[model samples]
Target chain A: MFSELNSILNTSPENCPQGEFTLVSDRKADASFLIHHFLSFYLRAGCKVCFLGLVQSFSHYSAVSQRLGVSLTQAREKGQLVFLEGLKGALGVLLEEEPSPGTHMLGFLRSPRSDLRELFEFVRASSTVLLSLGVRVGAVVDFAHYCRAFVCSKLQGNMVMLIRGEDEEEEECDEEGAEWLLRALTHQCSLALRVQGLPTGYCRDIHGQMEVFWRGHGSSVTGPQTQQKLFQYKVHDKGVSFFARGTSSAVL
Target chain B: MLLDIMQTNEVGGLVIIQDTVDCCGRQLLKGFIHCALKRDEVVHVLGFEVCENEFRGGLDSKFTQGLYFHDGYTDPLGWTECPPLTVHHFTPQDINTCLSQSEQLKTVTLVVDSLSWILRHHSPAIVCQRLQELRRGGALRSVLLLLHSDMHQQGIVGSLCHLATAVILVAPGMSGQHTVAKTTRRTKSGRVTREEECFSVSEDLTITIEAQSSCSGKTLPEPEEYEADPAANLTFNLRLSEVEREAKEKLSLPFVFSQEKKSALLHPRPGAGRILYEPDDNDDFDQEDPDDDLDV
Candidate 1:
C-alpha cells in the first residue's frame, strides 16, 4: 500500500500483516503530512478509508487529502471513504457548562457519561461497518490521546493513533506521565514511530527527524539492534520526503 | 517586519508568532498589530499574560486608539494606573465568551497573546477547533495573531502550527545580536513551505531581517588528507630556547649526590668478598606458647 513509507519502515505491503496498530508520536513538526500520506497509501491501495477526525476539520482534512492526489468526493461517492466528525460532540461533552434542555433534539451532547468507551466503541463500530464491505479498511484517528489504551486495544483493521506530547517544560516535570502514555500505547501497537522536529538552527532544509522504535505482533521484519533507523525529513509539495542526514539521496 | 513574509490583507487567516521564552514576542506582536492598524483594520487583543498598560507601554500613543484590549490577566478588583481608552476586564472563565463577542465585532485582527494559557484552561482539541472557527468564521473579517512561548505545551504548539496559515518561530540566536526566525506557511494551493532567516529586534520594537543569515549557501569544512605524505609526530617540550636554557642551568641548584650511602637500605649491602654466617633459630622461639596461662 505504501511504496516509500514501507521501505522507511522496512516492511512492504505484501509483507504487512493485518490488524496492526501503529502509533505516531509527534512533538513539534506538522504530522498532517504523515497522516495524509498514510491515508493516501491505503486509498491508493483500494482500501475503504474512514478518518475519525477529532481535532481537525473535515474541510482541512479533505483539502490535504485532495492535494495529495486522493479524490475525496469520488472516494465518498463510491462508498470507499467516510469521515467521522467526532470533535464537535466530544467538545460538547467536555464543555464546563451543561448543555441546556431541548439541545438534545438538536444533536448536542446531553449525556453525562464520563467514560470514553462509548467514543471508542462508536469509532470501532464505524470501522467495522467499513470492514464488512469486503475491502481493506484503514483508519486514522486524531486526538486519540483522549481514548484509553485498553479501549484502543479493541479496535480492528489497520489503525493508527496520533498522539501529541507535552511541551518542553511540562515534559520535563511530568515526563513520567508522557512516558507512561507512550509505553501504554506502544504496548498496544505493532509498530511505534516517533517524529521529532530538530531544533531549527542546525540545518537548512531538514526540519525534523523520525525513528522507528519497534514492530511487533504480525510483521516479518525484526527490530533493529544497537540503533533504529533514523532519517531527516522535509515537507514538500507532494508530501514529506525522508532523507538520511548528510546525504542527498532520499531514503524513501 | 513580521508581516513582510505574510499576506496582511487576506481575511479569515491565522498567523502564529512562536517565540522562545527569552525572545521579544510581545514586541513583534505589537509590530503586527500596528501593521494591521495601519491598513485600517480594527484590532482586538485578548491579553492573558500582560496587562493593558504593560502591553501598551512599548506601543505608540497613536496606535493605541485603534486597539481594543481585553485583559484576562487582571482581576475585576485590580486597580488601574492608566486612563483606559478601550480596555475591558472579564473573569478568567469568561475569556472564550469575551473572545467570541470581540471576534464578532472586530473588523481586522484578533490577537491572543497567551494561547498557552488558553490551552491550559481548555482542551487542546477544542482550542484548536475554536481557533480554526475564528479563522474561517464569517462573523469576523479578522486574522489571528497567536503569541505562544516555545517552552510550554509543545504538543499544543504543533497542533496550533498545523492549524495556522502561517507559523513564525522566533528564537534568540547564540550571540544575542539577532534572532533566528523560521517561518512555515501553508500556501493557497495547500502546499507547506518553510523559510528560515535571521532577524534583529530594534530598539523601536521593529524587526529587521538580517541580510547575511542565509543557511543555504553554507559549505562544509574540508576533510584532512591522511594518506598523502604523513609526517612524524613531534614531541612536546617544556624547555625554553638556548639562552633561556643556559640561564636556567646557571641558576640551577647544585646536585649534592650522596657518595654511595651503603646504609640507605634496611639492611646494609654485604661486600662481594665478605662471608656472612647464617643464624640457626628454632621456629618455636618466635611462636607464642599456646597455653600461656593468661586465661586463668
Candidate 2:
C-alpha cells in the first residue's frame, strides 16, 4: 500500500529503523492516510504495535486496515497489537465511579491538572512496541514531551505521532500550543512528514503536497546526510500515489 | 570568527543558541562545551531533553574529568522513586542547590541542555527572573542556554533575545555540507557586532568554521557597470542613415495635402462654379425653382 512512500523514505518494512521518532503532521489537508500507512507498514514488519487511538474508535481503523490487507482483529487475537481506544476509555472514565490510583489509562483526563505520568507508566508497562499516538496535541503538548523523554530515550523503541497543524480559525492559545508542539517534535523527530493543501486553492488531479525532512544528526540507523524533498500526492481508496511537482496527469 | 569569540571568552552574561526546526544547535552547544573544557574551566550540564550518556556520547573522554552531569531527564517530576537527581521544582534556589551539590565551588560554566522545556513548564517572566538571579549570584562564570526559537511565541523569544549578551541562530545552509550560524553579540562597551558564518561538526565533536562566501573578507562586492543599448543584437536596423533621413523628409504621402491643395479644396474662385449633369432617360427636367410654388 505504501511502497512508493517507502522507496522515497529509503527504507523497507523489514528494515525499518528502531528507536526513531517519526512525526506526521497536516495543514489545511487531511493526513489520515499517513497514519494508516504507518500502522500497516509497522505491523507487516512483525513489530509489537501499541496504538493509542485517540481520534477514532477501533472499528474505524479496523475497517481501513482491512482494505489495506492488514487484519487488526487477527493481530489483536495473536497478542501482537495493543489498541487503546481513547474516546471509549474517556467515556468509561467519566461514567464509572472513582477508580483507584494509577489504575485507569485515562486517569490524567479526569484530573484537574494536566499530568501524564500514569499514561507514561502504562506505556512503559506494555514495553518494547512501536507506540503510535493519534491525537490532537493542542490539549496535551506535555504528553508528547514526556514521550520524547522516556519512550524514545529509555525504552529503545520507535514512536510515530500524528498532530494537526495550525488553523486560522482556532483560538489564539490553542493555535500557539499546536504550532509549538509541531516545531518541537520536528526538532526531535528523525523524520518529519508534512502534508499541506495546494496554495492556489482546490485542484482536481493533485490532492496535496508533502514535505519530507530527514534530520541527519542522532539518527545512526539512517544515513548521516540530511535531506529535504517535496512531492505531490493523491490519496486513493487503498493507497496513495506520490509524484514530483508539476508532474501530475492533469498538468501533463 | 565564532571560534575566536568562544576562545577569547568575549561572550558573558547569558548566551543563547537559538535554533529552528530544520537545524539544531546541539552541535554548537557541544562545541561550546569543548571550548570551556579546553580552557580548563569546570563545566556543569543540566540536561532535560536527552539522557546523560546520550549527551556525552560523542565528546572526548579526557576532557570530561571536570564535567558534571545532573540528571533531570530521567524523572523530572519524580514519578519514579529513586531518580539520581530529580527536578520537582524550577526555582532559582532549587537550581542553585542542585549546582552546589558538585564539590568544586569555583567559577563554572553552566550549560542548560534546553531552556524551552523550562519555559514550557513555567511562565516566561518567572523563568527570566530566575535566570537573572542565577547570573547575579557570582558563583557562575557564564550561562549558556539552548532555545528552540520556533517553539515559542515572538514576544517570548524576543524577551529572551533582549536579555542575552549574545544570540547565535543556527539554520541549514544551501547544501548539507555546513550549517549557517548568525551571531549577534553585545559587547561590554555597548557596541554590537553581528557575524554570519558556516560551520560543520565532525563525528568526534570538533567544529570547522568558515565565513560565508558573500562576507568572506568583510568587503561589499563592487556593483557591475551597466550601459544602455536599445538595439544591441537586433537583426533589423533601428537607426536611420543621413541619406535615408533626407529622403524621408522629401517624400509626400497620399493623405498629407500641401498648403495650395488644402486652400483650393476648402474655397473656390467666384465665377468658377459649374455643375456637370447627365440626366437619365426616365428623368423629367423643369426650368422652375423647386420651392417657389410652396413659399412665395
**DockQ-based class of model 1:** incorrect
| Deviating ranges (above 4 Å) for candidate 2 | A94-103, A110-113, A128-139, A168-176, A217-226, A249-252, B10-12, B85-89, B100-107, B213-296
| lDDT by residue for model 2 (A1-252), tens | 489999998878889776677888888898888888888888898877888887888999999999999999999999888887776787778778666443497876666565766677677655334444544434355565567666667776678888887754343433346676777778767788999998887788889999998875453422223578999998887789999999987788
Report how far off residue A103 is in candidate 2 (Å).
8.9
Residue A13 lDDT in candidate 1: 37
What global local distance difference test value does model 2 have?
0.76
C-alpha local distance difference test of each model: 0.55, 0.76
DockQ of 2: 0.24
Global fold similarity of model 2 (TM-score): 0.77
For candidate 1, give the lDDT.
0.55
